[model samples]
Target: MMHKFLMSVYKEMLLLKRDFGGLVILFIMPLVLIITITLIQDSTFKSIHETKIPVLLVDNDNGQISETVKQNLNESGSFEIVTQIDGKTINEEVAREAVFKGKFQLAIVIPEKLSKDLQLKVNQNVEKILGSFGMEDTASVAQKNIKILPKEVKLYFDPATQLTFKNAVKSAIDKMISKIETQSIYATFQDQLGENDAPLFDQKSFISFKEIVPKVNDKEIMPNSVQHNVPAWALFAIFFVVVPLSINIVKEKSQGTLIRLITNPVPYAVVILGKTATYLIICMIQFFLMVAVGVYLFPYFGLPTLDVNGKLILMSIVALFSGLAAIGFGILLGTIAKTQEQSAPFGATSVVILAAIGGVWVPVFAMPKVMQYVSHVSPMNWGLNAFYDVLLRNGGIGEILPEIILLLLFFLLTTAIAIVYDKKKREV
Candidate 1:
């Protein structure tokens, strides 16, 4: 039985080899696509990394603090602040519209009386702190308790934009606010300290908290473009096996070869198993070859080479699961498709739709909430997520357990349905 299965597998390979042109195209097209896309996206990411995020600043306050905020943003080298154009002032609504229209990634509207409001906020904080510390009777307490109205700056941003840009803008704004408030506090403290000359309060021993982000190792970071494209194109190419696989199955069925095999002494399951094994081998070859191009050929194009972090075992597992899912999907399509015309459209269209929904064309996070929820059912999403977990997140096999299980379940479910359909057809 095992010998017959092996022979059947070899037969599948021999038949595939006969269509050498299509097979060669299948292997070459994904490599070409990955390289081309990586090169194209390289320039975009490079521009973002080399240049500052373009932001529009609407300074209605035109005050010292607002000017200082604008100066700080420009000096920080993270943003190119556009305040006005052609001697025309930009308003808050225009800034908001610019962000919404993608003219700018961020828009900041400095409200009127920003400096005064900020100064008032500082005084209120000092008064509250003094009261909490039981220093309400202090001579400076009455003067500090004078509260000023607070106003908020309106910030406009597209929620769908990348979070990194938004966070950078937010962090810069936070630092600007901190600086303004600290300066205010310092001025108030000097006035109060000079008057009170409190001997009980040890100014020299004052402790303050500081925030710092921990440093990451240089080798730990992978370029986002490389990480995304490598797995994305690989997933696309592997699933594309559906076309040829389904076509072969349809050809055999229409030619009466499958029926003849069913009438022969061999168990029908073994022949299907052999064909699946053949396609699985093809899937692995496709994966490794694409990875080789990424690791070897990409550096010549000024892109980062593929780095697997020595997780070959986890990588292999993902590839295996992806292959199984693809083969199962192909089998299901084959069982349903009665002719070449039916198989071609169904197989090709399904793969395209699945890839689009599964985030091959766009990141799932960037998709609409409904589509993102719907992406969960796509096997390609599971495979891509598993790849990203390892390549981008530096995760191990255990981290992708859920994805792995889902992929395996997808394979089993689809293959079972196809087998049931095959059995019913044979009985008829």
Candidate 2:
């Protein structure tokens, strides 16, 4: 059984080696894509990292908290704050256009009622605290006297903007808002109590920070370029396996190899398993080779080192599901496709479409809300998320369990469909 499986794998490998175009498409093409895109994105991320992103700040409030938040943002050095465009203060439509046109990375709008909202929140918190201490009527009066509506600082950015750029701006904004909020709480106490007396509320006590690091030291962390493209192009290449596998299956059936197999002493399941084993091995090779390029060759091109966070076990599980899902899809496509002409276009088109919607070409967050929801249906999205859990998130097996289960289900569904169709074909 083992010998037969080995033979099947050897045969596929030989065919793959001989098919120069297939070899290039499945392996070389994705590698080139990874290198090219990573290099391009690396420069952009590096620029953003090295220099502050340009952000348009539309401070409509002109109040205490808004001014403090603006001051904090300016002092943070994460942004080159643009208060004016072409000798005029930022206009909402113009700022949005600037962001859309790539003139600014982000636009932040501080609403006119920010100070009032913060004061209201403080008053409500005081009322709730007093109510807890059996002063219900006094608390009710305080709450009724101060009508505080909810408010949020509106952040504007282009839907097509890169994830890192958007995240940096958000992080900076969050910090600024936090500082203003802390001050607001302090100011509320100052108003209630005399300014000379210390405020009872400890803002630091209300907020805390925690850092999550991989098992490895901080210096060994993987770069964003490696973090993204490795799994992305690797999964893409693995799925592209469907094209050649489908073509081979169609060719084999046409040439009587499949017919000859059924007549042989070998069981049908072994033949199917052999083909699956062959493609699984091919997928593993493609993944490892890409990892090798990302780890070793990428540094030469100014990409970050992928000092793996000792999550090879987690990554291996992801790779297993990824390979299974690809092979299962290939088998299903093979079972349904009658000819190379049919399989080739269908397989290639499906992979490309899946990749586009799956956050392989672009981050899912950058996509429109509808597209983001639609992306969940793609197996590539699940695979990419599993990879992210291990690679970027420094997650354990438990963290990626959901994605693993989903990918497994995808594999089972596609393989079941293929098996059902095959059984029907045989019965007919």
Candidate 3:
């Protein structure tokens, strides 16, 4: 039985070798695809964090608030504060025109007397609070009942700017302004209570935010485009094996090779296993080559290097199961298809559709809630999750076992259906 299975595997290998050009294309094209996609996506990721956007600033206030805003914007390292254009200082009108005409993506105008009005408002509120607490004279609070109008800090956005970008900028500026207002109120209270008295409260932030990610060997392994794209596109390329594998099987059937194999004394399951093993080998090769490119070649292109370090074994386990699932699907597709034309196009299109809905094109979380639920049906999603578990989450065998089991079950189910379908056809 082992000898017959080995012979079956050898036959498939020989057939693949005969179509050497197609085989080479299968390997080369995926590498090209992964590299191109990683480069494009890495640039986008860098643009959001590493690249500073140039923003027009109209500092009409030129007071404490405006100065603080300018200083903070520069310190944030996300924006380049452009105060002048053509050697002329920009005012609110010029900034507005520049942004509206798309000369700049964003413009921030600090209204005149913003600091003064904000201070007056804070002082009045503080005096009222102190009076209510019996810490200040009620007569003095009643005498200064003048209301202060709110100051407007205008923000202009380019017509072409996306709504998300606009909202992000607005949210950031609003937080900064709120912090400034809170500080001003604190300062006013201190002045009213006399600086000589013990400090009431610390003006600095009591709470802050810090991002936490998975760690390896006591060092943070931040997830980057390389870590993400390598496994994702590798799995995509792995499943793409369905195309050629299905076409080969369909070709065998049309040419009577499958009929000859069926007539042989060897069990039918051995023959199917042989084909599955051959294609699984091809899938593994594709995955490792992609990982090699991500680790070695990506850095040359100014992209982050993929670090597989200790997770190579777990990755291989996921890739092996994913390959089996793909091969099972290919075998089933070839069994059902009548010709190469039917198998080839449908195999390719189905892989693409599976990839699309499976968090390959867009993240499942980013998809609409309905689609997110729908994505669970795609085997590709299971494979991708297993890959992410190993790569990003730094998961071990125990953590990735569920997805691995799903992939294995998918392989078994599809292969069983193919065998049953073929048997029924032969009986007829």
TM-score of each model, paired residue for residue: 0.71, 0.64, 0.89
Q: Count the backbone clashes (under 3 Å) in each candidate.
A: 0, 0, 0
| lDDT (Cα, tens digit) per residue for candidate 1, span 92-128 | 8877877898777788888898887776666667666
Candidate 2 lDDT, 134-250, residue by residue in tens: 654453474656666677788888778877767877887787777777777676656554455665665566657876556555454434777888889889988989999888888
Q: Is candidate 1 or candidate 3 better by TM-score?
A: 3
Off by over 4 Å in 2: 1-6, 47-223
Best of the candidates, lDDT: 3
Which residue pairs overlap in candidate 1's backbone? none
What is the TM-score ranking, best to worst? Answer: 3, 1, 2
TM-score of model number 1: 0.71
Candidate 2 versus the native: TM-score?
0.64
Cand. 3 Cα-lDDT = 0.90
Alpha-carbon deviation at 200 in model 1, angstroms: 12
